[model samples]
Target: MISQAITPRELDRRREQLVDLQRYLADQEREYAELRRRVQGFIDRYVATLGPLYMELDALESQLYCAMRYLHEALARNGLDTRGPDSPKATAMPQLLVLPAGAPLPPEPEGGLIQVGPPPLKTLYRRAAKRLHPDLAPDDAERGRRERKMAEVNEAYATSDRARLESLLLAAGESMVKVRGGDADAVMEWLRSTERAVQGRLRVVQAHIALLTNHQMHALGESVERAEKKGLDPLGIMANRLRAQITERRQELYIGQRLQPESSLTEAFLRQREQRLGGGLSAARAP
Candidate 1:
């Protein structure tokens, strides 16, 4: 249930609440942007120092994994009996299943891909564009001002930035308000709609803030801060860890190179093939 009539005091309170929520949401958004910027700065610095080796390692690992999977599938398709006496199941296998380095990897088995925006954001953008399109302005000067605002709107929509779109819509709405001339019922209706929009935008902003604060990169940044407090270089530590893995992998590959193909290559191929097939079966069986 909702009230149809509104007192002056209630309208004022709603106006103040809307303003406060907008300000708080803006501050939160700025804080999130700053945090993201700092995280990216750290990543850029780290990459500048170790990017080539890191990329090479990643490529090598991916190539190896793909080749192994391909060989396994080929063998199974050919009806090869892998459970024979000389199979990998009867031999000692080396630790070839190395885990990925600390850096984030792209999600696997990618399928669904789409561009999506919140319904509220899209509605606000449509409404704002209806009211603020530069071509609709009466005078050249006003048109110029609207042209600039329209640019902002276009950029916000391009990025699917909900906060920026909401702010632009609020600003445009406020500018159209005539404090002295409107009918009371019309003004009240406008107030109700504005209140709903503001409250809806505030919820979106708060959810975005929550997501940013709890993001993996944000958590990593906090970890780095904690490490700095103890006089440790967290980025350097990560670099050293990756370097150590690279050295170990190089050594393993070197040893594999020296062995006969029938020995190391066959063993590695069989082992990886078994693991792949077994994993597929296990996943199929999962509840």
Candidate 2:
């Protein structure tokens, strides 16, 4: 079985194929991250705009049901079959009552009991990478498309937005967390580490951009008033601007502030975010 080895040309070709596959894999990873970012942004935007409507709708529906029940009870006492045989009440009656139009609805459960699926580490990584794998691309134009997709995924993963990450994990059917022997500390540590590794650098870049914008706005006090009307804190913006200015002189100042014994960057960001969003967002500490 000691046959001669393959020719140099064949060996070279094999190497090239391997290289191509490696490049493709890298591209896939980047694409995955970008997809995650887009998903997170969409979720954020949706929650921002329609979360209230959902809350309102829930409340209204609850009130409507309760009122209808009271009304039904009253009618039953008075022996009125207002509900037709086709009505849902005909099968199993619920108490019915009525209230004025546009009246505030009774409170309902804020949200349903959510059933979280397993975490997805592998599936997301693969799907994301596949979407932008250069090997899968047939031509230069297609390769370029992959590159762009890869860039977005990279950026999104860099932000470490876990809500979107979880969504991606669900879609991909992978778990970031292991279930065999649950070590709470280890799991939390990994989560924290992953978040910081992904989100920290991008957040710093975003902060820089925000600082520049704030500085410009401070120069025009009129914009400050507009921000106030939008429920923004002028003083806090001013403070951030001041911090930015100081950080310019000492680049580590921001890092130091975030690394304080009491606060992590994620926690600080959430606190600031809550102040901006009327304290409606979930709270989590960053690494």
Candidate 3:
């Protein structure tokens, strides 16, 4: 069996391939960030505009359902409804949709084990602290900036986040790799581990991007954006439409409330809602 020889040429090729993957990963992550920002912004605006109206509409529906249910029971007490047992016991509570959370920006790993120098994580943390510590700042303004960064460094150190420490060090213009010399097999192992970590992050970025793209809200937001480009107020238009529905539902609730327990409209109203609300609200018969 021939022992696999790690050559300089082979190492260079691996470095180049890893660089390409890292570049692609960075681009994907950037795109994901921007996409999340836009989609979340759209959702926020939409809810701000239309959310109250929807709540009002649902409340009106609930009142109508309750009114109808009371009348239905009244009819049953009077032996009016021949339509037997199949009313929805109660209204189904609607579930709300929550936005997908942002994916964490993982750092690319960089370090050296030149004859096993001090523990890498501690070394990286010290490097980050030295660079980011607020006391090193020459001015109050710079000190404030450094303070925030220093907090991050402290947090990274407390949690033993090697990659985070390395990232902080890199951001402060500190070099992460400090190899005066190292074994070929060790270098190969480091390279493979880094590649695997990067590849795993790439998958996370891709999946998050897919999740944002495929969300129903994304398409709605796109439509709203396009409408805005054309000088159309799609959200405003939707708000107006909802207001109209609210006014109409209010009138319907008034009528339902005014409806005599034996009025023929009670039966018709229940029939109409049976299909709309899965007919579980109540079954009623009129005189």
| Cα-based lDDT for every prediction | 0.55, 0.42, 0.71
Tens-place lDDT digits, model 3, residues 1-287:
11158666677788788889889988998898888888888888888888888888878777876776787677778766633324323323222233344444333334442332334677677767777788999999999999999899889889987667767777789753541124556666767878887888888778878888888789999999999999999999999998998898798788778888778776677666556555454444444
Residue range 1-287, candidate 1, lDDT tens digits = 01347455565666577668667756765775676577666556656656765775665555444444444444445543343222222112111121122222223211111111124556667777887899899999999999999899989988988678777876776322221112334444655665566566556656655765665656776787799899998878877887887675565445433544345365554455446447321111112
After the best TM-score superposition of candidate 3, give how far the Cα of residue 106 lies from its true spot, in angstroms: 12
Of candidate 1, the 10-residue stretch with the lowest lDDT total is: 108-117
RMSD to the native, candidate 2?
34.6
Error of 2 at 178 (Å): 38
After TM-score superposition, the amount by which residue 76's alpha carbon in candidate 2 deviates from its true location, in angstroms, is 4.4
Q: After best superposition, candidate 1 residue 285: deviation in angstroms?
A: 26
Say which prediction, candidate 1 or candidate 3, comes out ahead on TM-score.
Answer: 3
Off by over 4 Å in 1: 1-10, 46-51, 66-180, 255-259, 264-287
- What overall lDDT, based on C-alpha atoms, would model 3 receive against the true structure? 0.71
lDDT rank order? 3, 1, 2
Candidate 2 global CA lDDT score: 0.42
Which candidate number has the best lDDT? 3
